[model samples]
Target: MTGICIQATHRRGGFDLDVQAGFSDGRVTAILGGSGAGKSTLLRLVAGLESLKTGRIHVGGRTWADAAAGLHLPPQKRSVGYVFQDYALFDHMSVAGNIAFGIKGSRKERGREASRWCERMHLDGLAERTPDTLSGGQRQRVALARALAPDPDILLLDEPFSAIDTHLKRKLTDDLKDVLRDRPRAVLMVTHALEEARTVADDIAVMAGGRVMRLGTASDVTDDPRAHEVAVLTGWRNLLAVGWMSGNRMGGAWGAVDLDHPAPVDAAWIGIRPERIRIESQPGAGLPAIIKSVRDFGPVREAECVLGCGATLTVHKAWDTPLPAPGTRVGLVLPGEHVRPLTEGRAMAAVDRCDARGRQARA
Candidate 1:
């Protein structure tokens, strides 16, 4: 099956974007970044809603834009499907009508295509309902169905789950994943939520400053040495400044810890997901800390601790786990493998290191 490849330049506000990306067929590639990272701008460029200053876009082996060659395809000419964040359904159209709107065929053929999409999206029972009467998740399903009914070669989703409630987001994400599985189309989704990206994407692109800072499989990018910024953006809780390092052992302001493997020198930050941290009643080859607070976040409990050296860390435990009360003394154990060494300096510097290393490894 064919996929999508884009190298585009566009201007938005005072920011200018120079982005190049490729989406593989039958896979979900998530565009992950912080706010104002130009994710939406990239989506608009792919959808043909924004004019490109210089670049090219190819979908399913067809060139849609080639600025140097003066080839630019309009939105209608490009076989792309777009599902907006707001569920931009037509107020005058019912669920079935909306799904059938973009399909080009006889009335019977359109109706059959709409019904198939409605069934696939679980909107059969609500086919007669108008957009206003549908719940948020239902409306989102309708929007997705409408986009898919046209049978486009590429799918572009711009924060597709942003408007849904937290409780429903997971379910919708799973549903969407099931619907897109094994389909011979390139999928690009933009989301600020890291958990959402983690759940739905096979590959991830971390964007910042109007450019893609890193792009790889989820594991490759997340495990990259320069992915501290991505981890921080993904809600990683414990980021301690590194004080020193000797061989495979590292010392931070909080405490000294050992790494399972050797890391490059000049490490600036130590990243540990709070959930990976463990707390014990007594100091057991770990840092001694005083519990500062216990926060309840429904199914999980979080204990905030301050080490003797003044550095703070957090540990997540099941709500049922017996947690130490505030003011209690505890030991914070960071296993060797969980201590990720972060590269020093700005975000792009790390990306440069990662790219260089990748090239050397490939060579």
Candidate 2:
């Protein structure tokens, strides 16, 4: 029942944001989007950095911004903590100094608060060190500790791990995840990194063109959605134009293939992850394709094949599998259940169909 609720409409510079979204407390919600998708703008609106043009923005039972009632709480007035994109640490401030900046109390009390967060963030010995001397990971932890030191009910993190190197980023992400798990406050972290979202977030909101196009749990968004839009963001390699066929089948690049369910009305295309594609060695086991290209990438070998329909699609095989020479004809094992029809049965229609199919399948 307690959460960050938002319904707002803000427009600027050819970008229009009109979304009504909610994120429960005691969870981390990652807003995933591409550059210029208004991810930061939404965060700013929640943080009170930007005024709400219309609708309400509420956090943890308190109304932060309600344009209908002309109520707008300034960022400083609201109980919120923010970790900026670059960490935003003061060059002159030591780690402890940065942490104590947002804490309200006597010097001794603030020092105690800072010390508490330092310990939680695994920054005991580095308290006296300035930002310039610390590594990117340390600086990030210090910034996080500083924001969280105040014990704000709502926390906003703007791509906190984007600047760090790969090795340090993973380590820092694990540390940050632990820090967040220990605390059950409402959190919203915005990032363009899919792996980070998959690793860190409990919930995900897929954003595009200044709005959340889809909202679901991490698994729902990543592993199961299967729609072309969500699939594209989460590693699907092929999204080919197609036409619906009879008997719950689709006609696309590789010709007519069966579907697990009825074809969605108005479907414009079909989606398939390259990894889901299987290359068969036999002559007549499956759809015919000829090897066209190959690339070796350690764990998996990627090969593109030209289908009889004259369309090229990529396929993945385990590194141990023998590679087919160029022009060698191969059969494709594209499962019906795994192939996702795109732009079909979206909105409430999809939900209704899903529920009905779920019941029918269970029955």
TM-score, every prediction: 0.86, 0.90
Over 4 Å off in model 1, which ranges?
219-225, 280-284, 344-363
lDDT of 1: 0.81
What do the candidate models score in CA lDDT, each in turn? Answer: 0.81, 0.79
Give the per-residue lDDT of model 1 (tens digit) for 1-363: 457777778886889887766667788889998888889889888888887888777776677877888888899998888999897899799899999999999999998888888888888888888988999999988988898888888889999999999999899899888888867788999999988888889988888778877777877666543556666765667888888888998886677889999877767788887888888887564799999999989999999999988888989899899898899988889998888887643444312211211111110
RMSD of each: 3.9, 4.9
- Give the range of the ten consecutive residues with the poorest summed lDDT in model 2: 353-362
lDDT score, candidate 2:
0.79
lDDT of model 1, residue 323: 92
Clashes of each: 0, 0
For 1-363, candidate 2 gives per-residue lDDT tens digits of 267777788888788887667777788988888888788999999999988889778776677888878989999999888999988899898899999999999999999989888887889999898988998888898989888888898889999888799878777777778888966777899989988888788888777777776677888777654455666666667766775577687886567777899877766677777888878889986679899988889899989988897877888878777888988999987788877777632342211101211111110
